[model samples]
Target chain A: MSAVALESVTVHAGGKSIVDGVSLSVQPGEWLSILGPNGAGKTTLLRVLAGTIGFRGEAALRGRRIRRLHRRDVARLVALVPQTPVVPHAMTVAEYVLLGRTPHLSLLAQEGEDDRTIAAAALARLDLEELSGRELGSLSGGELRRAVIARGLAQAAPILLLDEPTAALDIGHQQQVLELVDRLRREEGLTVVAAMHDLTLAAQYGDRIVLVDDGRIVAEGPPAEVLTAERLASLYGAQVRVLFDGTTPVVVPVRT
Target chain B: MTAAREHGLPAVSAPHVGVPWTLVALAVLAGAVLVGLLVGPVPIGIGPIAGSALAHVPFLDAGTQLEAAQEAIVWELRFPRVVLGALVGGMLALSGASYQGVFRNPLADPYLLGVAAGAGFGATLVIAYGPTGVDGFVLPLASFAGGVAAVAAAYLVGRSVGGGRTTATLILAGVTVAAFLTAAQTFVQQQNTESLNEVYTWLLGGLATSGWGDVLTVLPYVAISAAVLLVHRRTLDVLAVGDEEALALGLDVTRVRLLLVGAATLGTAAAVAVSGLIGFVGIVVPHLVRLLVSSSYRVILPLTVVVGAAFLVLADVLARSILSPAELPIGVVTAFVGAPFFALVLRTTRSSA
Candidate 1:
């Protein structure tokens, strides 16, 4: 069964269609990476799938229309980690992570012991146990990104959406974070949809890749089939050489 | 525990609790109330007054030996005035804290959206054109209506601009409305020079003539609004992250913002209606509480209420006794203290950044 299905979803903003009519579906527990250059509406599509943006067309989760679902219900099924989340300067890492338990709580209910255990476990998984009491503003870029991902993990949703999950990380941290996400997917049967800028990383970790350009899907298939040198040069307007180490294709820009 | 330690698992620290801090705040408020009751122009014996006040609490008789006039001065005038001051102060601080949380701006106050200017205009109109023989209730009712209307207008204007997405736009709308209302108030003051003193006194804010009636008038509105705001304290914590984040977290950010703004504005309107335009209590108290206590609304909101009550009661005492026999406007005292504290906060925040 498909975990998510979008039929001709479109989003308009500022007299322009940011996300044109686009249809796609993700199978249960599959890792789908959305690869596109800047200004390609990747973020907009992710927002639409997360139900945070107003969009026209049908978006369904497990055969249910997304528009009909209460926001709380959608939240219980899906979690989205934004590209650059605003961190409250004075908020502790633990408090921020605990906020993910909001959907499971009643309106006036406070966080209980069970909720605390979940949040703490998420932090521990992210190797943030020592920094749990630290203020968010005091963390480095890598630590902050991990904290945000930890928050998404604490939500315990079946489907996770990540927007530029490793934008500012070094190579080592980048590999660590992606490996962690991939491990979680395998262990928990999580359906992961990620918008990525790193083509090599996307081709490696993504079970399937969807290439988008100008608010439309240009190509959709397995990474090896979709990430061709001609398609990359045409989409990015840059000369690129595709090298393969074993079966994985690595793209590096050709020197003029 | 020993087995887990041996297994090399990370230990979870306990959450930072608020009970001990709350007890400390309660003690401070109790002391402030005691001081407020004892100090006044007409010197009253602390023992007798305290005894008389405590004697009224059923099942406990502290005993009182005081003249009728002394009892009247303590029970009838001073006690009610102090209580009214506490209520107004608490309402203003709570409203300010709610505004700050909703707008995600530290500088947002109860009057940021023009509640004070609108209420002032309303009072000015009553002083200028209302029948000379109008009762005391007329002025408060008019001002409350005016205040509510002004905020409603501000909210509408803000919504019309940017769909209320940007805090800057809402603040701009508030400034425009406040300027227009203040101009209208000035025109009324100029036209009715004879009533200028009355208008000025009301605008400057004082509890000199406070009675049980004034307290009773605003009580229900304050109670309801405060309860509503207290219930949403956790929602405010979620909002601190950002609107989009809050929405993604399953909160209806728009609906929560509207409900909170409505409750805070209504409570603020009621407070300003009774006490005129008390400056700085709203802005100063919440920031102070956040600085001294935790920033979480769960702690900030309740502590703001208690500390605001204590702070204002002390300020009222100073206002009356500063220039003995000739009372200073309570607004003047708050501004005097609040302006310096605000500057200090700005400096500290800037330096830290």
Candidate 2:
């Protein structure tokens, strides 16, 4: 069954159509990357899917209209790991990740054993077990990004919406995070959708790519078809060279 | 890590969560309370007088002169002040913590949006001009009204700008409102120089003149407002990631914001109503509590209540007796100590967390 479906999704910001009539669908455990340039409504599209913005069209999760679902209930089914990791002061790694269990908890109920166990397990999955006791303020940017993903994992949501998940990370940490996300999908049947700026990373990890430009999907399907050198150049308005890194098509753009 | 299980308290599965810190806070509160009861300008000793003091009982009628002095001090003189301090302090601290949470800035104080400034003007009018123009309880009532009015004005201005979505705009509106209120207060105070001492002294803030009547008068409102905040702690957690995030978490952002802000305003207004205008307890106490509780309102909120009570009680003790014959306005004492200590804490911590 399809996990999340968006149809004719239109988003406006400052009276301009930022995401105009864009549509996408994801099956269970499938990975989809939404690729676009700066101000190309990449984050905005993620926000719409995350139900953080008002859009004209239908968004459904597991056949339920998104508008009808209670927000915390929706949060339980879908998690959004934003582009930036904004952690409040003095919040411990364990404590921060445990907030993912908030939807499941009653208004006054404190975190039980199962919640802690889930949070610790999620931390372990991301290799953040050692950092559980540390304050979030002390974390490196890469570690902070990992922490946010750990939080998303702790939510145990079927659908994960990530906005520029690897934007601030070093290459090593980027690979570690992406590989962990992929592993989560394969092992736990989690649907992953990331708004990605790097065409190479998008083509590398995504099972399918949706190319968006000027708030609309210019092309969609296999990375090979959607990430053509000619299309990349025209869409981003930059000089770009596309090469096959073994099975994956990688795009390297040169500023003109 | 389910490590500790005690009988009286709920078995805390999350040992690292706020349980231990809360115990520590309770211990400090007890110590502060004891100190407040025992110490005064008149030194009460341990051995001879202490023994005689213990001799007094309900059935035995062994009450001594020492017991009378103790009663006079504890019940008559110091208790009301300490109780008011604790109540007002707790109110300010909780409101501050919640305000900072709502704004998503640690720097945001409880009085951020001109409540104190406008209330200052209203209070100045009452103190300088006297309640002859109005009726009984007019001063505090006017001050409370002004506090609510100021926040309402700021909120309206912010909504007009962008539905309170923009922090910069909200803060700017608050500043404008404050400036306007301050100007009005200055003009009024200048016109009434005959009561300048009264006006300025009230503005500095203290619990010196407030007796049991003032304490009883302000207690219910502050307590109710604080209780309202405590009940809505979880909704505040949703607000930690900004309104958009909280909205996605199924909270009616606008309504919750209004409720939370209103609760804060009510609590702060009550505190101001009783104590005049004590500042920074709201900012400092919550930050300190967050330091101990690690930023959970579940932790910060209750801890702030205990710690704030203890802090204000201690500060009042210092304010009253530090100069013997003359007393400092509790606000001055707190600011003098709080400002330097705040700078030190900021310098030491590097970042607020």
Candidate 3:
């Protein structure tokens, strides 16, 4: 079953449709990258898939309509790592990870031993175990992004949705995060959907790519096909060279 | 064994930290209760008060001097006052904590939604007119009504003017309501010179007018409102994250906010009814509790309750004994203490703002 499927979805805000009639899918154990320029509705589409927004059409997660799925059930199947999640100054890294258990918890219940174990393991995987007791406000930009990812991992959901998780990270951390997601997908049969700015990174890691422009999907397919210089130029409105590194696409912008 | 998780560990540690706070509260409360029984206008030590109330008062030995003093001071003068102070103080702290969680602002005090000013106006009107004007219980009931009405009004105005957009409008509307109520109260107080003392006394707040009946009267209201707030604690935590996430988390954000704000307002108004407008407690206790405990409302709310009860008890004892024979207002003592502690909180924690 598809981990997520959107059908003719349109999102409106402030009397404007941020996403218009877009349909997409993420399959189990597959890594899909959503590439778009700013204000291109990548985030809106993710929100629709994450079941966090009201849209004109349907978003189904795990063969069930996202709106119909109970939030806990949806959360149990999919983990959404929001862009710019407010890292509360006083929350310890451990406690921040514990929030991922909210959906799993009984309405009146607290985190149990199993929840703690999952959180601890996720931290160790992200190399954040040493910083578990540290407050979130103290982390570097790269570390903060990793901390949030660790939290989503702690949720133990099979499908992971990230909104520009590497936007604020340095190039190495970006590579690390993308590599980690790829590894997670390969090992755990996780469905990973990421909204990313760097087409090169997306091309390297994504099994399939969806390109969005001006709140609409323009072209989507394998990177070698979608990242043609003309498609890159039109999608980005910048002249660029799309080179083949033995069948992989490498985007290089050309001025004049 | 008091965890919320199904099969969760009840005895999660840092008992070293948790135990000391409990010990401190117990010691302070014990000392306060002892002193509350012993010291007053009439001299009665613990031994004498205990001897009289337990052994002598009902046994036809009431004719004796020590027993009579015990009866007069311990039962009549001090006990009700101390208990009332604790009840009111706990209610304020409970409410203050609830508001802080709902508004996601540490600066949110019990009076943030204009409950205090509006309630003060209601009580002031009653005082200005005196017994001839209204029936007994009219003051408390009206003040309670006024407080709920004020918060509801603020929420309504806030909703219309961008409450959905941000929490800033609610804050602004609260300030607007507070200003209008204060202006009306000031106008009423100014017009009637004879009522000035009554108005000031109500505004300053105290436990001086308390009796066993007053303590008994407010307890159930406080408890009920507090319990309702406690049940919605998790929803309040989700709210701190933001409306969108909370909605996505399966909580109806609008209903949750109204329920919490109403419960908090009810608790605050009930406390103000008997205790007048005792200041600082609802704001300070939650802030202090958050500094020590995890940011989770589950820990924060309970700690606020225990700490608030202890604080008010200690403050009441000081107010009664500080200048002796003549009592100071409980509100003054709390402000005198709460302000500096708040500064310390600012120094230690980076301001979220």
Candidate 4:
């Protein structure tokens, strides 16, 4: 069964369709990258799959309907790293990451020894062990971005959803983060769905690309087929050149 | 692998404030309770109070050496007052912390959602319009109903106006309800000029008239509310991450929020009903614990209970002892300390931000 299946999903807000008639599926351990311009409903679609917002159509995980699942159960299956997470300035990095254990424990139960072990492993996985004792507000932008991903990693979910995970990070840190995520996916057999702004990075990592515009899927295929210069110009309304480095498509904007 | 292996798992469990701090807090509470029992206008020794308290315990042969009047002062008056102070203080602080966590606002207090104004209005209604010589519990019951009703109205209004999903709208709704209720209370006070003294006394807040009955009145509410808040301590920490992230982590954000607000409101109303509208305990005590101890709700909630209970009991001791025969209202004492401390917290938070 597919790891996630969204069939004709639609989200409406303020009398406008934010995500309309969107259907997509991801198999186990596959990385599906969503590429869209600003306000093209990429974030809204991710929110629907995360089960944080209401939707009209069916969104299922591992063949079970998401709407039928309890919030805690849905949380156990998927973990979301938001575009910009609220940082409690006083909370230590360890405490912030341990929040991922929420769905695993009973409502009234605190994090036990086992939960801490898992959280610690997640920290080590992200090379955040040294900074685990540091406050989140004290971290640099790249470090904070990694800490946020570390929190998502600690959730121990089978599927990971990242919304603009590379935003606000230096190119080197962005590469480090995407490489780490890819490593975790390969090793843990985790399914990955990411909404990415950088088309070249998306092409480098995504097993399949789904390009969306105005709440609808405009293109869906491998990076090479979907990222042609003509389509990019028409959709993005920019003069962009697509160069092929071996098989991966690299998008570069050209001045008029 | 080296980093993971070398770090081991123990580092993750390192607490910001550990067990020693808890012991110190408990010691402070015990000392405060002891001082409350021993110090008063009528200088009573700790021996007699301890002996009498132990003498009541089953199978204890401890004998009391106090005269009948002193025993009455110890058991009937001071003991109940101290217990009631602790309950009200602890409830207020716990509720305040819960409110802050739920709304993600550092300044949220137990009275933020109109409980004080509502209770004041309720008390004013009874004092001004009701027949004289009614049961003492009648006023408390009316105030309790009024406080709960005010919060309910605020919530309903918040929902209607701003969908209740946003905390700002709820807070604004609370301010609106508070203004209307305070106006109602003032109008009632104006009409019944003769009852102004009584209304004023109640509004200023005090535990001077507390008895065993008052202790019993607020106990169940305090216990249940404290339990609910304590259980949700970890959940409150989850909320620190904001609504969307918390939801992604599997928390039923709306349901948990409602449960917390309901529990805090219930306890705050009960505390206000018996003790009148005691201010600053909710806001100041939690902020103090956050400053001196740990900021995590897991630590803050429990430590604030002990610290707040002790703080209030000590404040009550000062309230009754400072003026001798003429008692200063307990609210006056808390506000005097609280207002400055509140300013300090505001400055520190601002600087940190």
Candidate 5:
């Protein structure tokens, strides 16, 4: 069964369509990467799917229309890790992650022992146990990114939406974060939707890639089929060389 | 991995530290209240006053005797003033802390949305033009109405400006409204210089003439507002991240913002109505609690109540006794101490950041 489905979803702002009519679906436990240039409405589409914004057409989660679901119910099914979430300077790493348990809690209920255990386990998975006690202001950029991903993981939602999950990380940390997410997807049957910029990384990790440009999906298929030199040149308006290793394609920009 | 392997899972639980800190705060509040009761222009012995207070408690009796004049001074004058001070202090601090959390701005206070200026303008109007023998409720009623009106205007302006999405715009709206109201108040004061002293006294804030009726007037509003804010302590924590994240986490961000702003403003208006415009208790107490205790609102909100009560009672003590006989405005005393402490907080936070 499809975990998420959007049909003719449209978002307009300031007399311009931020997310033009777009239709897509993701099956349970599948990893879908949305690749696009800057200002391509990738974030807006993610927001639409997360039910954080208003849209014109149908958006559904787990076969139910997103608008019909309670905000808390939608939150329980989907989690979005934003591109650059604001971190409270004085908040501790553990405290920030524990906020993921909010959907499961009643209006006046406190975070119980079970919630703490889940958060602690997420911290351990992210190798953030050491920094759990540290204030957010003290974390490095990579550590902060890991903490944010850990928070998403702690939400325990079936579907995860990550926007530029590895934007600020070094190569080693990037691999670790993506690998951790991929492992979780496999082990827990978790469906993942990521809005990513790196073509190589998205091609490697994404089971399928959707290329969005100007608020519309231009191409959608296997990474090898969609990430061609012609498509790359037109989409990015830059000269690029596509290198093929076995069945995998690696994009390399051709310097003039 | 090395750090984790060495220490096992680092303690992810919120430190079980709130209880001890709360108990210490309660003790400090008790000591401050005792000092507030005993030290005044008309000296009263601690033993007899303590005994008299205990005697009044249901099912408790303490054998002590006091002169009639001393008893009247303690019961009729000092006790109500201290209680009123505590109530106003707790309301302002709690409202301030909640405002900061909701806006996710450390600079937010109870009056950030123009409650003080509104209340000042309202009081000035009453002093300048009201009948000579107005009833006790008239001034407080006008002040409360003015405060609520100001915040309402600010909220409307903020919503109109940025659809209420940005805290910066809301604060800007508040500053604009505050400036307008202050100018109006100054104009009124100039027109009625005969009532200027009364206007100035109310603007500066004091609890010199508090009675049980004054305490009773604000009690219900303060109680209800405080309860509502306390229940949303966790919600405030969610809001600290930002609106989009909070909404994504299943919180009704707009509803929470409206409820918090409404409750905080209502309580603050009631407080300012009774006690005039007591400054810094709202801004200083919550930050102090955050610095010393916990940053979580669950801890910060409850602690702000006790610590604010204690701090204000102590400040009021200094206000009345500083020069002896001639009392200083409570606002002056709070600013004197709060400015330096705020500076220290800024320096420390900056260096650490």
Candidate 6:
């Protein structure tokens, strides 16, 4: 069975369809990357899979309808790393990471020893153990992103949704974050879906890429097939050169 | 565990940072209750007060060295007043902290969503048109109804204006509803000129007339509200991450918000109905607790309950004793402290941002 499936999913907001009819499926342990320009409904599609927004379409996780599932059940199956998460400034990193355990605990139940151990494991996996006692406000930009990823890891969900996960990171940190996610996906047999803006990184890491524009899929396939120079120029409305580096596609913007 | 340590990851324990804070808060509350019982116009000594309290315990024979009048002052008057102050203070602080969590606004207080105005309008209406010698039930009941109604109206108005999507719209609707209710209350006060003194006294807020009846009347509502707020302390912490993130983390954001708001409103209304319109205890006490303890709502909320209770009982003591005869309004004392602290919070948050 597919890990996540969407049949003609559509989301409307402010009198317009932010995510138009879209249909797709992700296999278990597959890495599916969504690339789009601004306002292309990429993030909205991820939100639909995360079950954080309402959509007018059939969306299912492991054969169960998403809308029919309780929020806690959905959370136990999927975890989302929001692009611009609100970080409570005074919240310590340990406390912030523990929020991921909310789905497992009863409403009034405090975090248990098992939950803390899991959170600590996630923090360690993300190389954030040293920053555990530091407040979120004190972290650098890259550290904050990693902390957010640690939170998602602590959820212990099989399917992960990342929205612009590398937006603010430097090149080294970007590679570190993406490599960490790739390792987790490989080692744990986790399904990975990411909405990314960097085409080169998408080409390098995405096993399959889906290019969207105006809330609809415009192209889909391997990076080499979908990210040609002509297609990138016409779809992105930018002049760019597509280079092949040992079967991997590299996108470089060209001056007008 | 060995593998994790190999990667230099420490096996962190549960972040139980609140044990000491809980003890401190409970100690403060105990001290405040003892002070409330001992210090009064009758000047009862601590030894005698403890002796008087111990004398009432079963299987204990502590000397009851106090006269009947002094005993009555401690038990009949000051005892009920302190208990009422505690209930009102705890409710306001808990509600205030919950409101701040739900709205993610630092300035949010128990009165943010029109409770004060609604209760004021209700009490003013009763005082203006009701019979001169109406029983105590009429006024408090009317005030309760008015407070609940005002919040209901605000909620309805907020929902009508797409408040379901964002808390900003709901807060705006609260401002509008509060303004309208305050105007109506002013009109009633102007019309009933003879009742102005009584209305003024109530508007200023006090626990001066508190008794066993007032204590009993507000106890159940306060208890229910406090229980709900305390249970949702962790949920409030989740809400701090914003609506979309909180929802993604498996919370029913809209439902959680509605339930918490309802709980806070119920407690605030009940407390207001009995204690008049005590201000700042809601804002001041919760913020102080937050400053002193961990910012996590798990810590801030429970600590706020005890600290708020202690703070208000002590403030009420000052209200009644500062002038030594003519009592100052409790609301005035809280505002004096709350307003400056509010400014300090604003400035610090601004600088940090």
Docking quality of model 4: it rates as: medium
Candidate 6, B1-353: lDDT as tens digits = 44445656666554444567778889999999988998777788998888899999988977798899888898889999999999899899999999888888776675667877898898889899999776366776687778778888877998899845566677788788989999999999999999999898888888975449889888888999899999998999999998888888899988998889888887887888778898878888877877877777888788888888998999998888898798999998888888898888878766433
Model with the higher DockQ, candidate 2 or 3: 2
Task: Please compute the TM-score of chain B alone for each predicted structure, in the order given.
Answer: 0.89, 0.84, 0.84, 0.89, 0.89, 0.90
What TM-score, to 2 decimals, does candidate 4 have?
0.95
* Model 4 agreement with the true structure over B1-353: per-residue lDDT tens digits: 23334667426763434779889989999999899889887888887788888888888888888889999888888889889999999998999899889888787775677877887788789889988977366676677678778878988998899776666677788888999999989988999999999888878889975458888878888899899998889889899999889999999988998899878877887788778788999989899889887789988999889988999999999998898888899999999999999888878877453
- The 0-to-1 C-alpha lDDT of every candidate, in the order given, reads 0.85, 0.78, 0.77, 0.87, 0.86, 0.87
Model 1: per-residue Cα lDDT over B1-353, one tens digit each: 23323445344332343788889888988888888888987888778876787877888866778788888888888889888889999999999899889988776775667878887898789889998856366766677778777877877898798697677777778778888999999999999999898888888888875459888977888899899999889999999888888888899988999899888877887788778899788889989878887778888888888888888899999999989789899999999999999788777666332
Q: What are the per-residue Cα lDDT tens digits for candidate 6 across A1-256?
A: 9999999999999999988999999999999999989989999999999998899989999988999999999999999999999989999888889899989988878887678778888998888888999999999999999999999999999999999999989999899999999999999888999999999999999999999999999999888899988887778899999888999999999898
- TM-score of candidate 6 against the unseen true structure: 0.95
DockQ, model 4, C-alpha based: 0.61
Error of 4 at B218 (Å): 1.1
Those runs of model 4 whose alpha carbons end farther than 4 Å from true positions after fitting are B1-10, B14-17, B129-141, B152-173, B351-353
How close is candidate 1 at the interface, in terms of C-alpha RMSD after superposing the true interface residues?
3.2
lDDT of 5 by residue, B5-48 (tens): 34465556643346689789999999988898999987678878
> Compared with the true structure, what per-residue lDDT tens digits does model 3 show for residues A1-256?
8888988998999899899999988788888899989999988887887677889988888899877887678777778888878666666787777777767876656667677777767777788867877888898988888888887887888889889978878889999988888888888888998898899989998989999987789989988888888877776789998887888999998889
Lowest lDDT sum, 10 consecutive residues, model 4 chain A, at: A110-119
DockQ of 2: 0.28
Residue A117 CA error for candidate 4 (Å)?
1.1
